[model samples]
Target: MKKIHHAEASSYFIEAKDNEAFHDQRLWDLRQKRDREAAVIPEFQELRNLASQIKEHTLTHLAEYLEQFEAKAQANGVTVHWALDAAEHNRIVYDLLTDHSVRTLVKSKSMLTEECELRPFLERRGIEVIETDLGERIQQLDNEPPSHIVVPAVHKLRGDVAKVFARTLDTDPDNDDPNYLSEQMRVKTRHFFVDAEAGMTGGNFAVAETGGVVVCTNEGNADLSANVPPLFIASVGIEKLVPRLDDLAVFIRLLSRSALGSPITQYTSHFRAPRKSGEMHIILVDNGRSERLGMEEFWYSLKCIRCGACMNTCPVYRRSGGLSYGAVYSGPIGIILNPTHDMRKYSSLPFASTLNGSCTHVCPVKINIHEQIYGWRRVLAKHNQLPFVKKAAMKVAGKILSDPQKYRKTIDVADAAIEHLPRFLLYSRMNAWGRQREVPAPPDQTFHAWYLKNREGKQ
Candidate 1:
């Protein structure tokens, strides 16, 4: 896959904002209602705490839970595979399809697969893979990465999709009605449901106690994908594990409401095993998750339900847009996860956030997102990722702030500089603060200066 530069990414970010505002406004209204209801519910906060604890405990003993999950799944007639990273995960899935001589695959929306670039990998191997999720399918045809995990094509307008469908499916471009477009997509995608030899999905939650994989989808594509094909594969991150089936009630209740403001998704299917006569495969992908868990301060990010509530509430995310993060996972969760995978590859992600703490507040499982970003900055700095100018500036500031005499002198200089600063200098590209808003001019004198002149003699 070709990597997008920050400048190119920003252009897409601008497009995403214009395309998503309507849906975003609707989601915001629903989110306010959900927030009000959650506040009134006496147990909501307690449940969040419990969920956090459960996730912490589960992650601490991930090796054990994974072992138990794999054993039980295999015993229940499900084939389990493990991949150390994204390449291995993609290869494992591709090999399974090749062995079965399956050429076409119908997939439900799976960010895990997207992270691994599964569709492109398969297409390179001469297999046709169709994304059945409406949003995903739109992005697939557009040849763009999903801007948002839940709303894959949130960056695309109805007209944008209509254009793509017109080109790909030979539909009329003049008809941009969502209903007409959806019906056309339904007709185009229905053939894959019957003719495709394999169906793939991402696991929402894997129950360690029962070895069942639960998938939540509003479109019902996951259920259709799982049942229609003789060979079914579920690709999931290793962190998506709950201890038992009962725990799903808490997560399910929180997930949809947080994600799209729905009371519940239209479909929530649990696959205990495959079809009685067909094959079922589960690929447990680590892909740097274990490394992330090793970092105590950042480990809580594993608890994310991919609800995207955090993204919606996040001020930085709202303004900068999802593509600014430069990862498959975006918003608060992406900031932590992206750096863990490859800091050099995602060095820009953590710094992109404003550390506003809104993501942490909206998180269903209460992951401390802002703190993790702070921790990442420390880690990045320790590793010498800071720019030379910033390092020099910080070193000077630190030395001055640490000494009273130096600090007093620095303040005097700052007062003089503020008074004399030119407009061009204040608005220069070198200063990030000036990039967006104007800095206020300083007062005539410092408090220390005024106090000494006016009150020292009186005292």
Candidate 2:
């Protein structure tokens, strides 16, 4: 799949506007259902808090926890490998395949694998990798990045998918029924499962105490992927750890409800060791996450369960679309993660939001996303990476606001100009706000004028 560049991602948002209103209405309906399901749970907030605290505490002592996890995993007859970065992670997996003489692999949904671009890397080494998830399969055919974390092809319509499947799977384009297309895909994918030598999956939560890797999926694709293949490889970020097995319930409760409006995903498989004498491999990937963990303001982002609730609830995300963020993860989480990888590449993300606080409110983990965006602004300014025009404007504004005389003069001039302000000046390229809204004309009388008139002899 061609990696969608930032410009292309931004273009998706512009293109989406030309579509009918029904698309947005559908999203609104889905979002409302998600919210309603979340609201019915009386202990949702408490669960979020507990989950946050558990993650925070776990991360603080990550080194010890990781060591414990590795020990338990090895004890359970699983071979564990540590990768310092994406490149290392890919090479390790590829080497394992080469060592085993594996030719093909079937994989469940694993963002970490996507982050490492594992499939492409393996393919480059002459090993074919097939994505098992339906959404992922759609994206694979489209040659595009996953638009939504949970729903990889969420941006695609049934027609879009039908076109892709017709071209890739040779399905009949006349039959656009989802069930037919799904059955066709099932038949095609079944071959890969039977022939593939390895199964790859992403870990939702890795139990530190027992070395268990828990994978949640609605389609049971992960189980099929793991069970069908003799070699099961599970890749997870180091932060996806909890102290014990019972802790899984709290996260499981919040994850599916926030992700797809389900109380729980249909399938949650826990793999502590290989099945039927199959070899199990666990790869713990750092991939700049260790650096992100060190930054206090942005560290809370690690607590994300990849449920994508933050994106679904964000007004900006709804309008701009996931592609605009220009990262593997989009929406509120992407805004923070994008900058961490390459601040210059995603410089526009933090400022793209209205700071409305909706993303933070909906986050399953109580991450203060809005405040972190502000912090990123400060960091960018400190690094002198802010755009020159914005910096200069802020400087001038600060100078005027700091000087009472200049401020009063500017206010009076602004009040005078309002009577004759041009529509374009108030509604042009200077800001997007004016494009969608009519800027209220300044009050005819300044507050100082009104105060003096109303306070005859009060002072």
Candidate 3:
């Protein structure tokens, strides 16, 4: 597959300015709410600092903690599995379903599963996998990937959702009412909950001390999926492990407040062991995370709680939308992490950001996201992964910037081009940056010229 550059893909999003503004407003609203919540807590920054320290400690002793967690979980009768990559993760889940003769499986919102493409992997093997989360289910039915990590359907308007329901669920065609649509989905999801032979959830955090997987959700889908079925599987990233159960107090305090501006999610459920007469499994997936740990400068990206406050605060993410990044993870963190995972595949991601550093300030874990993105740009350039057009532009810019006389002459020419050139000539297909944005005309005279003409005379 030809990878779409961030600029090219984001052009489609930019063309729909109205939709982009709507999306931007919604996310900014969440950002404002988060600010409100932070204002009330005198210890908010202290909590963030403590949480960062706990994550740092946990990651530093990750191997030891993982082994201890496995031992404890095994003692509690929860089978533990480790996957080195996405393929292994998918195979393990499929093997478990086949062994149990599971025809249907219900799953809560799991970005890890999406990362592994587990749904299609199982479906191709003749297993029915139903998404239990309301947002996830909507995307599943629409046969599309999520646009946002938290609000998966954020790109869709209410009318768009209503039309989807009308076509898929046979609901009233004109009914765009939120309460009615939710009730309709509620009525249908209950049936899937009962019929599923197995259920799966993604853990927000794994408590190493208690052999517990903690899941937080607003819709209670994670709890329903885990409890209704006889067999339960929790797919967790290796980075999700916290050393102690008491640490949940710090994490839980920041999670919803940062992500949705709520005091807490509606459900904060912890699974310590298998239910009586039921089977439980935990799959620990590394999938490049172990390698990421060794990267000194970039390793802190693992501290992310996935609250998505960075995305909410990112100017590029708000304007361009998540789909433009062309990766499972998006925004500032995605720009850094995606390239770290596979630079050849996602080299363009680092260029997607404006390097404003807003993401670092809003991060609950204090990932230096913008700085990492800047670092990735250098890495990509060293490897000669930069696009031909960008390299040419940079080469010319470098030469002009290095010479004062050349710079002034170039500026004069640019001002002339802006004033005398036709709009089509300046904003044509050749100009990637100008394709979706207006190129402001430079001032008619240079600052140096004005300084000599006016400032010197005034003096």
Candidate 4:
């Protein structure tokens, strides 16, 4: 049986108390850093506006741009392949690897691979996949999907990493020093870069004018992934495409500042063709992107550049932890993206927010994230995807609030219960709100009663 998102988030919140606090503070720190970085750029808002327009223009003319990209890539001596969905994307990757007779494949962090479930698909067919990105490697060894996109293992402490390394890499579990752990991982995986028969990377931006796949990484691992092996492949989502190389200026300015509070990524590699003697292939994957584009309320989501800014600023995401979303994408972005992929599995997500609008404010591409989340709730209710208990409760609450006399009567009854009822019954399993939060002490008197008392004399 699938546990609903509310249950999953509640369990994480209750059990990971230490991690929960750290996660909240740490992400808030990132949010602060983002604000500081944004403050320095005099044209920050202007860049965001330009980026949103560029994306909207590209998406509206997506077909023409994609065709232009494919043609340019082909002209640049690159083999271009298209996949309509995840299964096809996986198959295309598997065949390409098998064709090159690759046994051990070294890959950098590619959410596209995770979205396509490519690692397991290849492993089942006797391919050994090595994750070259440190965070990705940690999650891989632990047998978990990445918790956060930019920082995949952000939920874990250095101590947790020491334990994971001890179990897998035979390092000292007690020595949780960051430098020692990083060096240990580096020394252990260095050979995979040289020995692997092939390498793969995810594209951050695909330029249609030059037909180049641009990847941004802080670690420089993506560069090694693309250049080291004789056989190279880049898995790029179609939405990552921009019309011209110059248009990259706007996104390049905003991407890191919004994501990690850095001026720019350490490595912004552009790959147009294979190396002198090596071969290269690019997989342009739709994977439901085209269908999502047709959705009027949600099509703006495609403008996302995977910055994770909204995630950092989101109070619910910071407190609940990214894994609570139980999907490839998490946080505000996930809340909107997951439902379109699977309504039944992710219907609880839209309701996970406070509709705070903080996410919309922080978005580099200006996506109306909170409004979209609210829109999803309406969509879910219409489609009967909301859970039975919630549907019934909303119905009752609607009735009570619609008529003023009934509302006042219910409020009086609730005030009496909170004031006089036993603690056990007041906070029993039946009270969902009380489960995660303390119900405030009953007011000295109902506001309505106080208003009647004071305002009666004034009138």
Query: Whose lDDT is greatest here?
Result: 4
Better of 1 and 3 by TM-score: 3
**Candidate 4 runs further than 4 Å off:** 1-3, 412-430, 435-438, 441-459
lDDT of 1 by residue, 339-437 (tens): 777776776666777788888887889998888988998988999876565566677666766888966765655555564333223332335665557
Backbone clash pairs for candidate 3 read none
Give candidate 3's whole-model lDDT.
Answer: 0.87
Worst 10 residues of 3 by lDDT: 421-430
Candidate 4, 1-459: lDDT as tens digits: 263566566575648888888888888999899999999989999999999999999999999999999999999999999999999988988898888899999999999899999999999999999998899999999999998889999888889999999999999999999999999999999899999989999999999999999999988899888899999999999999999989998999999999988899999999999999999999999988999999999999999999999999999888887888989999999999988888888889998899999999999999999999999999999999888866776676677668899767656655554643433323223356566687677666677888888997897
Task: Using lDDT as the measure, name the better of candidate 1 and candidate 4.
Answer: 4
Task: State the weakest 10-residue window (summed lDDT) of model 2.
Answer: 420-429
Compose the digit string of candidate 3's lDDT tens values, residues 196-220. 9999999999988888899999999
User: What would the TM-score be for candidate 3 when compared with the true structure?
Assistant: 0.92
State the C-alpha lDDT per candidate: 0.82, 0.82, 0.87, 0.89
Runs in model 3 deviating more than 4 A are 16-18, 408-445, 450-459
Full ranking by lDDT: 4, 3, 2, 1
How many residue pairs in model 4 have overlapping backbones?
Answer: 0
Q: Estimate each model's TM-score.
A: 0.92, 0.92, 0.92, 0.94
Top model number, TM-score: 4
Model 2 TM-score is 0.92
